[model samples]
Target chain A: DTAVSQTPKYLVTQMGNDKSIKCEQNLGHDTMYWYKQDSKKFLKIMFSYNNKELIINETVPNRFSPKSPDKAHLNLHINSLELGDSAVYFCASSQDLRNYGYTFGSGTRLTVV
Target chain B: TQLLEQSPQFLSIQEGENLTVYCNSSSVFSSLQWYRQEPGEGPVLLVTVVTGGEVKKLKRLTFQFGDARKDSSLHITAAQPGDTGLYLCAGDVTGQGGKLIFGQGTELSVKP
Candidate 1:
């Protein structure tokens, strides 16, 4: 089975629209993270959850919210998305928060028009 | 501030050519990892180097971590067209649990 999976591989929506991206990890990892890859190919961490508890919340705008129902799932919800929000969103999981490599999902490409 | 800075942001070379990518940081790290990302896919972990001055080899690819744990390098030998992708270096600073940082990444294009 795929280790980590993100739904809606591609998304295109009008500006100001709201959407949610779903992510699931079957690797039984303790920490799950959400990352945003920009047009410049820069990867930035947006949020991190360890066993359903929010740990790292970067300086992202309040429009983006992340919810973790359990240790295996972490979802990202964007409210009134803006044009600058168009980018690829990736979901990742790691057994440890400190020194281990992460397993990342295929990613969801969000395009705002 | 970008804690980790990667050099040679873009590299285009012919098949069978060798290349090296570098990741530098001022802050010390507990562990550093190398990942390769292709279009429409997430970055895949290629190797992890934790010890300072440690070197690891995976076939034609070689990874080295600085002795001070503040820098790292990836060397690919006789690269093939299939090796074209975005190479990223990420690290976890000492005692910072949630502060893992990723370099800007190097876009590698190996022409046939």
Candidate 2:
């Protein structure tokens, strides 16, 4: 079984359009995270939720919002997507928030035209 | 913001060659982790080092954590084409609320 999964493996939308990516983990982890990987392959943490509580909010813009309905799911909604939003978004989960070893999903490739 | 600087952003080598990738930071970390990512996939954990001057081996890969806890290295012996991927190192600082600071990443291409 896939421990972590993200929906819509590929997404293409025009500028100013809004889109959402869904992530789910069956590892029974307490913390889930959203990460953005740019064209340079630099991965940066955008948000993190531990047991449905917002814990880490990086320097991301307000246009991007993360929602965790429960401990098993975390979704990212991008408002008014721009060309800069074109990248791969990865969903990850860890048993501990302080630990660096996380199980990640395959990732959703989002391209804004 | 804490930064983890990785050297030799790109590397290409023939099969059976040995290579080393380094991850450095100015701040100390409680733990350091190494992850390998293939195309169109999220990074998978290779190993995690917590103690200073600690070394861990996973088959052909050897990971080392600096005594100061501010740097780490990954060494592969007789690398094969299966080893080709992006290697990322992440560090966890104290009181950071479980957020890991990632390196810029090293892309390794092993050609047979």
Top DockQ: which candidate number?
2
Give the range of the ten consecutive residues with the poorest summed lDDT in model 2 chain B.
B92-101
Off by over 4 Å in 2: none
Which residue runs of candidate 1 sit more than 4 Å off their true CA positions? none
Give lDDT tens digits, candidate 2, residues B21-112.
99999999999999999998899999989999999999999999999999999999999999999999999888777788899999999999
- For A1-113, candidate 2 gives per-residue lDDT tens digits of 89999999999999999999999999889999999999999989999999999998998999999999999999999999999999999999999776658999999999998
Residue range A1-113, candidate 1, lDDT tens digits: 99999999999999999999999999889999999999998999998898899888888999999999999999999999899999999999989677579899999999999
All candidates' chain B TM-scores are 0.95, 0.98
lDDT measured at residue A78 in model 1 versus the true structure, 0 to 100: 99
Which ten residues in a row are the worst by lDDT in model 1 chain A?
A: A94-103
